[model samples]
Target: MENSTVPETKKDVLKMVHKFKTTFQRLLSRENQNVIETDYEKCETNTDIEKKVFGTQKDWMNLFEDPSEDAKCNQFAKHIEDGLKEAREKHLKCEILIPCGLTMRIARDILIMSESEPCGVRGCSLIIHLQEKSNCTELVKLQYDPTTVSTFEIHLTLQEDTRHVVSVRKMMMQLTGCFKHSTYKSTPKMLCLAYKLEKQKLYRANC
Candidate 1:
């Protein structure tokens, strides 16, 4: 009888997967139908930069899921925002080696974050923290909820990390699961990152 139940459970799981695949395909197909459906970079990159500099204007998503592309993007963006904040508090600068070019030195100060509502939106207020603040620019959005705690957003005018400057937001947001938690005595914040500059694929964003 237990073995019979196992097959039924497998069938149920398959049904769910089928539903998900169908829905995803439908949405993707509709997106593809546009006469000039741009590349995935176009699909994922932030649409605006100047208007998005604050980081407090947005939440993680509009209306769809935990691990969907949108969800993953938000998670990664939150990670970069929080990591930079933590790293800055402990060390004046956190060094990120460019894939092949110069190193980026990010600065963080204790004043960067607070237990209460942050001052003047983070991306704009903290423009002083980025290494490329001049040649390139940034915008950020942050959201906090009694339930979700915190989720952050960033838009950049330069491509220090990816093909398009704004596209880096997707890479940053791709760091973790679309659904996550921080219940047990508060979760960990990264104070350091040490990705090897030469071996791009060896680590998960280094540290």
Candidate 2:
């Protein structure tokens, strides 16, 4: 009987190699396509999550762009209180409301940095530096029409630190211009003018 096994040809070997290579390439391309699709889906999911959290892209960016003043003030308030050394260690806590025209509009968002200064006569002084938003100047211009100046700073001084109540009261009066019995353009004169007008109308009707 003759040898049953036949010798493999170079052409046959080359064809087998090519087939294997083609199969491997197809698998590699499919894997790459799957990876790209997965990444795209993940990015879309992140976008949706962000939209749910912040409502919109502009609103999300604003959280980082605008200054958080209320949070800063709340952080500062904690350090403002302390204990004093006496026979018994007494704790002194001060609650303060800063009244200023600068804070009227941007009170929540305006950045305030405060430092304590020791005064010779008064107990202490709190100097707060303010920074408004980037477009604050433009916003103020659009909102207000000033007579002499577009923007101004006011300095409020008190008789002493203990007289904060009196100082705040006086400042409130000056800023808002509201008093219990304050007359606008003279109330008596306005009433007299009204009476004269009424009398003249009556006389014309009689004639």
Candidate 3:
């Protein structure tokens, strides 16, 4: 009787271990499914927000190509406004690269400039002055002068080893400076401008 009871006890212990293992696996499978569902929901939410902010892909493409239409221009301006707001809220630094040529023309139109001037320059004198003030090995900083309207102050410093790229700081919501493209022969130069969007007024006001 004792020998028979020992075998029965061993069988009971084995059944208990198998039940626990199966239960743990089921819980793990449910947790994984929940994670996947949550990720899918987040992805759907982001897609909806993107669609709301920037219409369809074709609409955005057309807007970038030709911002001559007031409605399209307003949409682009709103996009920029959203970006600025998001950056501020997230405490992020934002930078915009305005390439030379057709894109630059579109930017000028969006900024409501009368003439198709590169870097939004009203005259050649300012471009010449900026080119003269710039150096190859130094980082140049340009900021709007408070004393004079549209006047900029230039600051230069030795290029550090870590500073491989040149960037304009403190020129928020305005054209900072124009620089020659380091690479790419087709595109000769590019403009650094951070725009502050003012909806319908963006077409009327100069930045």
Candidate-wise lDDT, in order: 0.30, 0.24, 0.29
Compared with the true structure, the alpha-carbon lDDT of candidate 2 equals 0.24
| Candidate 1 positional error at 6, Å | 50
lDDT of 3: 0.29
Who is ahead in TM-score, 1 or 2?
1
Among all windows of ten consecutive residues in candidate 2, which has the lowest summed lDDT? 190-199
Task: Give candidate 3's error at residue 30 in angstroms.
Answer: 61
What ordering of candidates by TM-score runs from best to worst?
Answer: 1, 3, 2
Q: Which ten residues in a row are the worst by lDDT in model 1?
A: 101-110
List the candidate 1 regions with Cα displacement exceeding 4 Å. 1-48, 52-67, 93-199, 203-207
lDDT of 3 by residue, 18-136 (tens): 34643554454344211111122233333453344334443333333233544444543444344334433333223323212222222223333312323222211110011112433
Residue runs of model 2 more than 4 Å from their true location after superposition = 1-67, 82-207
**Candidate 2: residue 27 Cα off by (Å):** 62
Per-prediction TM-score to the true structure, in the order listed = 0.22, 0.14, 0.19
- Candidates 2 and 3 compared by lDDT, better number: 3
Q: Against the correct fold, how does model 1 do in TM-score?
A: 0.22
lDDT of 3 at 116: 31
Q: Rank the candidates by lDDT, best first.
A: 1, 3, 2
- Find the candidate with the highest TM-score and give its number: 1
